[model samples]
Target: MLKKSHLLCLCFSSTLLSGVAIAQNAVIVNGKAIPKTQLDKLVQKSGQPDNPQVRDQAREMLVTRELIIQEADKRGVIQKESVREQLEQSRVGVLVAAVFEDYVEKEGVTEAELKATYESMKSQYSGKEYHVEHILVEKESDAKAIIAQIKSGGNFEDIAKAKSKDPGSAPNGGDLGYVNEKSLVPEFSKAMVQLKNGQVSD
Candidate 1:
């Protein structure tokens, strides 16, 4: 019984409402509208297969975390000096990491820079590759102590397993396997090329 104009109007209204709902993908918790992006980010971080179950779990986690945060705010836990400092540090770390990632993606090494680096290190890359192992520590004092221990016949692999902070290589005795010298950072390449086989840098 609807007129042609009324039917067209109804269709238009339905299309707009559907578009808005699809764009928002809103998940409401109490009165809050949690963004779908947060759920997507959580799932990506979990490294799990993206399926309904994983999404449900992520949604539950977000809701619980939000509830706890709300409770903390109500009790003024965020006002504590130590908590404020920790939160600020976490914020800085996240922002700095994001900047580094964005910068690397948008400003990757140019061909000219690569050519210059290659030219400077051509001697080190004379058709010979090197297998590299390294133990990384935060302090020069720690590095010196490790070097001393190695000089006195302490096992390099054992020391690497115990002290190296590099998660990817530490478990494998700090072994980076075979690598092209040019692929290494300049300082590392310079030091590595100076070492004789089976010799550790002083």
Candidate 2:
């Protein structure tokens, strides 16, 4: 009993309703399909409970974002020069990071390389080391007297404690502890390197 135009109108309305229902089931926005995986990822990133309420909130956020993106695309905002440059820069940054990560995974440091580096650096720290002591005096005669006294079996540490003028070493019986040759003056280094173990330098 319906006229021809009414039948056509009914068919068109049915088609539009069918399209809208399909879009709702697929979570489409402006004909763009938004996957469920995206919602899962967003929920995981939010660090919230995986309950229905959280999922609904995340879905809403994604839908709103998609709407904004679609509007931006419609206005040609994405085609602007500055926006394109920024997008390119972001893409390059991501690519560079991925490349470095891949390179590290494929060509990482080996134990042999580490050992070689250690060997190469070892020599710099392997030079001569010395433990030394001294009795500082202003007069040559006093020095000779102290050395003669030590040579005659007088306790060198006791004599240094009593007479050495160096405030830094005097309190510890003139103990200089262990030192590297490079750290000493040339004259001291020469004298220290020449002495045998347990021998005192005059």
Highest lDDT: give the candidate number.
Answer: 1
Work out the TM-score per prediction. 0.40, 0.39
Backbone clashes (count) for model 2: 0
Candidate 2 local lDDT, 112-197, one digit each (tens): 97799898767545797777888889999999999999999999889998999987787778889988777778898888899998
Whole-model alpha-carbon lDDT for candidate 2: 0.78
Listing every candidate in turn, what is its Cα RMSD in Å to the true structure after a full C-alpha superposition?
A: 16.5, 26.9
RMSD of 1: 16.5
lDDT, candidate 1, 1-202, per-residue tens:
2465673221111111135654564366555667778888999999999999998899778877766676667779899886898899999999999997897799987789889989877866667688999999999999999999999999999999999998778888999999877788999989999999998997
Query: Candidate 1: lDDT of 34?
Result: 70
Model 1's alpha-carbon lDDT is 0.81
